[model samples]
Target chain A: MISSLTQAERGAAMLITLSGMVAGLAMAAAGRGDPMGAHGWIVLAFFALFFGLLVRAAYETEAPEDRSLAYYDDPTKVGILIALAWAVIAMGMGLWVAAQLAWPDLRFDAAWSGFGRLRPVHTSGVIFGFGGNALIATSFHIMQRTSRARMPGQVAPWFVLFGFNLFCLIAASGYLMGVTQSKEYAEPEWYADIWLVVVWVVYFVLYIRTLARRREPHIYVANWYYLAFILVVAVLHIVNNLAVPASWTGAKSYSAFSGVQDAMTQWWYGHNAVAFFLTSGFLGMLYYFLPKRAGRPIYSYRLSILSFWGITFFYIWAGSHHLHYTALPHWVQTLGMTFSVMLLVPSWASAGNALMTLNGAWRKVRDDATLRFMMVAAVFYGLSTFEGSFMAIRPVNGLSHYTDWTIGHVHAGAMGWVALITFGAIYALVPGLWRRETIYSWKAVEWHFWLALAGTVIYVFAMWNSGIIQGLMWRTYGESGTLLYSFTDSLVAMHPYYVARAFGGLLFVTGAIIGAWNVVMTIRHVPRQIPAQDRPTTPKTMEPALPAAE
Target chain B: MEISHELFVGFSKSFGLFYLIALSVGITLYAFWPSLAGRFDKAAKSILDDEDGPCR
Candidate 1:
């Protein structure tokens, strides 16, 4: 990795690392008495280690090949490996969290081991750590190929990838140390949030720079989604994480908004994080990889346009639905419900477009596990969006709010749609990035597909049953019209479902382990091969294609 | 000359709805415009040519 960089780039990287080391040391000194000090030490150690490695490789010569002739992919490779590692760790945390709910005695007598602290670790780790890395990696790969241009800078890509991982590390470690801002998805404290802002700005600049240099006259459909994901997520993260830290040296901070405003702001950030982060970005992956793997074009360019703009417009208003039946005004809630239901139109349009693209490629879907992952993901995307719109209705929210039913709904999207699509993209990506003909074991992928599908089914069904039962029991009344079931009654009822959920999580994580091992073995054992038509230096005479609407 | 909180809310309540509706319509018109079909088709088929590597 170090040898690939020119000497000048290496010098610049060293300077950046040195500055980061200084910042870490200052934080450690300033926050000496608090948990913030420990975090400061972690940041210091991380940068120091990188700086040492860079210094060790300072005498190494630059690679002879012209980097601009080829797409820069070293960072994407590292990002994928990092993402898979996070997948195993975070999903394992999720499984542990599930088991604790089933058998409350599953934890040690430690604050970090308790449900409250560990739950956010699982949530943020999977969503931001695993999911965020996958988006960044695949976005890099997809953006370059679709545009036919190299990333504009060498160090900037590495900075973005590693800086983002630094932020994720701080976030996961902070939760274990009880250093949260207490917001749901936006949990890391003020300093960590600030770091992410820096990383994200660089990421956005890098993306636009590459897009600006595209050989194609028209930008691909996938680039639009990736750009939206990068651009909108920055706005959401900045606006939602606005806070006043009590002391710069301490971890505690107060939100800028309070009461109902705070609730609205949090969900707006939260739900759109779902919309843009989880939904749009993965849709970018689906748009590119699914069709590429299937040897087909996207079915409808017009529908793609409609879904892109519709989702961008409609999903923003739908955030208020998360605050239903609360201190929020009814009109706002109604508006949220209205848009959420309307959102189903474009959501299904995209999903249907994907399935329709597979019309002639059904044989591939039958045989190829990687393509099957994407197929099942689209089905889940359609199912969950319908479920989401239904649950957002005021009357339906009444039964679902604060119940395990909400949890069930989340896993349907998270496990079924988000995770399945990510795994599929990874399987598609790994062989290509490494220049291998195919994966090490097709049987493992087949096993993984069945395991993952069965796991998601078992998980979603268990949640549905438990959630409905819990919701009904809580609302139940006896002859005197008083509530019949005690709160413990719901807890007892949840025990069996919790066990099932944990078992499902185990299967999913097991598949992930298998997938990760397959990747490692493929990288180590597979013979290197290059494509005949794929060399970056090849000259092309094809005309650049433009979009119709543009 | 200050825009008070309630005033802003009321303005948004009335104006935001119509503005969003207009935007949605505009997007729809742009997407379905007949002239774009040729370009869109070409663009869709554009990615099919790239396999196993970056486009040249």
Candidate 2:
């Protein structure tokens, strides 16, 4: 009976199972006196019925007439749309909360609206919600296209999608309620972390399974990077999040390490999160999309492979750069700084290859806003990597460590590199997946391009100005051998730059909104009817050709 | 020294350094080897084999 159903129906049933179990857990956790218990039981019962109906629906639906027609699964299309929704939510909150720096008067009476809580919501939401979903969705899409195999199957893919989002949901709600584990980028509590582990392991298996089924003799370059991303993230997440729960039922947990050891573990995880999550996965995207859009292969396959291993091996050592001025040993800090400097070579190898792929296609780069987004993203990748290497130097880090300069550097990377490449890849993928002939509006793409460019410029400038000013003011010594400026004096001086930073953020949010609208319209678009001149000409004769002229 | 952060940091000075250098050199040699060029080329082209031209 189950064999009679389609993959889509099976996917729907899997969602039912996932939701039902989660609802059951919520009800169990609620206990008797909890105010949410009534609501929990209701949701649980709803899921139970929903599960039954989904199963019934699956049994009734007919399987596809041709097995070959459904070779690739498409949960990615749904994942992409949801990723856009998250990007909007994440950036919207980011702008609102950031504006509060200039107008701290925007403060709300509610605890959830506090800048402290909203900051995590913005970080995690963008990194995980926006960026994570894009990585998963694009990885699934690129994995299938490269491997020439169906997705690992219907139910498992849905499990990954639904389960990962469940983790995101728990994380967001938990933060609002003040239930974090207090580790930046690793803040989700023990249960959420464990659930992410399960979801990620399944994702790894699914990727390996797809590769094993490939029609080609060799796995592609993109798959190698994607695999590194998945495996290393799992390692990083588990090692960084080792903690003992205060109790079985409560959301509180304590890290396994304390003092300087804890700080070391956190930065190791933090900087590498930038390494793996921000860099590696998007390098996978860059490998696929840039070449495909430019209608050329990467300039040097050898460089990519060398760089791939180079980045993976070196990024692990560079995390201690985040701990330079801290209690971490001088030798350890030197090791990190040295490897970080070494990293620039490999990082640029990939970034340079992306640009070189477009070498003969400069005309295409000029004309296409999509390609321009990608090209600029590569340039920023090169620029930011160079910046990171120098910034890791002890003297440079000493001056820049805790200033808004660090914020400037981060936005250069986050706004400039990570977000741009993701945007470029999305623009390329949407039309292909949505079965549209072109974007619903190229005008919107152009608008998005300028808006994002302007926003990033304004943001970087404002932060750089404010950060350098803050650093110099704080360090300035009076001729009397006394500190020149009070700490509050720096804050007073920073208000204008804060307002400018907020303005930049608003502009970025606007660009993202425009991008979201363009994508939505494109997805809803019907394929245009090609006019006679526009359509490819068909051969007039229907005569069968003789086989070989025999 | 015990098997601890202190011990590990001490060990990392030489052992960790050599391990990474070795890994980098090994990967570089493997990537640039003459015999594997054809395989790399095939992998590069694999993403294009099933293309139906971007639904456009």
Candidate 3:
């Protein structure tokens, strides 16, 4: 069975096994005493060995000449599954942490289970793992199809995919083990950060080379957005993660930045991670899938180009808005706030472009769950971006910052826009990648849509009201000029809202489960009987294997 | 090389902002450039041209 794969597949399989062996050895050395470490090595050993065997077991096949003509890849297939799996985990983590806040006893006395540790897991898991994989999978699919050319080489995409996921593993496991720099979103210690840097560089090179191979006259506007996302994210990851490790094993590290510089650096990394990682990449998905699904032309092709450059230029400087009223220079804070406000222009441009593109396609939007997901995602994109700019102003930040209001804002974007759009992209891709007519069940897609909608609405509104009440309570004063309400009073008030938020999260995860079911069933339905008639003699044996008649 | 710190900062603050604004405006104009309307229209519908079959 192993003999059927191309030379590249076999080479990749062997490389994966060797890397696992090296990981296992490293784990034995570093985790010499810790079960977590020992367990990590053992898992790597098994994972590598299993994949090696699986690759070896794959039935060998010779590709027909027509197969290489247009480049579509299965890395995307693996990517969407990883994205859904991460969504389930990250949403679960979000729910657990929210519960812990409502009832502190939920920590269960395990240090790793404590809110402090798991919070990073929730953030990193959703942002990098879930969002990152969706971007990777969709970008590869788009690049190949839009360019009308194969990726320059095959193994690089897999290397970037697996390598990035490996870094996600290191980051998550390290956080639980108390190995972190404690920098908001850049929490992974120096080693994990470095590994990500390497993976990101490979991703960038692969993108550029693929674009270089494009037969299309103009690199579709979608590829441009995806490319900008790759390029900007690479720069941000490297600069923000510059750190000195205490040991060679990379379990701990110190930032190259310090004092206000460190704070600024961290938030710069934090916000742009939102910008480039979440916004930019997903916008790439929107550009392609929204138009394709809406059965409409992009409302304005030029607007996309303008918005792309506008966002790329302005977003880099807006990170300092997270540092308002800090020790950072007043001028810098003002500059950050200015850029943050200006960002609304391009953001709306992108959002409006998408919404306008759906102008004539509202009937399709009504009928198609996948298109509805994209359309609603566009609306949330507009809504959250408007809110983001409002919060950046120090006066507004004064009330909203350090409250569940901020949490609500983040989730509105994360849950509403990011996850929703990813589902849309995956829904569009699943049938195409597997060469099926459509999903196994549009009924499930409809279920996911409403469940996700109800959850987001409940989660966000509950937080908004709770946050405003908490902020108002914290500031209430008596005639005696003494504070009228203690912090605990606000906590007591927030109790019910916390419960609602947790319940909202439960709904979110349930929707994701439905989505996962939809994805798996769709893939399973794609016919796979072609290899048995492996002898390629025009259409003699192949004709009957085709699912066209179905 | 001999520029004062304030001068350098001022230059960056003013020139950089202006350059970006100009570039953004330029791209927007170019996109809506009347002559390019047909090209943009075709590009918008490019996903459907000459496909092997219905991708449905």
Winning model by DockQ: 1
Worst 10 residues of 3 chain A by lDDT: A530-539
lDDT of 3 by residue, A1-550 (tens): 2443355565666776677667667766776655436445754765576576756665555342343433546678888899889988888899999889888999999989988899999999999889999999999888867655566545677778877888888778877877678888888766567668888899988888767665556778888888888888888888888988776543567789999989998888788889988899899999999998887878888889889888888898898888878898888888889999999999999999999999988899999999999999999999999999999998888788788999999999999999999999889888767767678999999999999988998999999999899888877899999999999899999999999999899898899999998899888875532222111122222122122322
Q: How many residue pairs clash per model?
A: 2, 0, 1
Q: In model 1, where do residues sit more than 4 Å from their true spots?
A: A535-550, B1-5, B52-56
TM-score per candidate for chain A alone: 0.97, 0.90, 0.91
lDDT for residue A452 in candidate 1, whole number 0-100: 87
- How well is each residue in A72-133 modelled by candidate 2, as lDDT tens digits? 43678878888889899999888988788888878766888888888888889989998899
Best by TM-score: 1
lDDT tens per residue, model 1, A1-550: 8987777778889999999999999999999988788889999999999899999998877665565457788889999999999999999999999999998888877889999989998999999889999999999898778777677657898999999999999999999988888899999999999999999999999898777767677888898998899999999999999999999898888999999999999999999999999999999999998898899999898899999999999999899999888999888899899999999998999999999999999999999999999999999999999999999999999998898889988988998999999999999989878989889999999988888888889999999999999989999999999999999999999999999999999999999999999999999998887765542323232321211111
The collision pairs in model 1 are A548-B36, A548-B40
Write down the worst ten-residue block by lDDT for model 2 chain A. Answer: A532-541
Superposed model 2: Cα runs more than 4 Å off: A1-59, A528-550, B4-6, B53-56
Docking class of 3: acceptable
Against the native chain B, each candidate's TM-score is: 0.76, 0.74, 0.67
| Candidate 1 accuracy as lDDT | 0.89
In candidate 3, list every pair of residues with a backbone clash: A4-A60
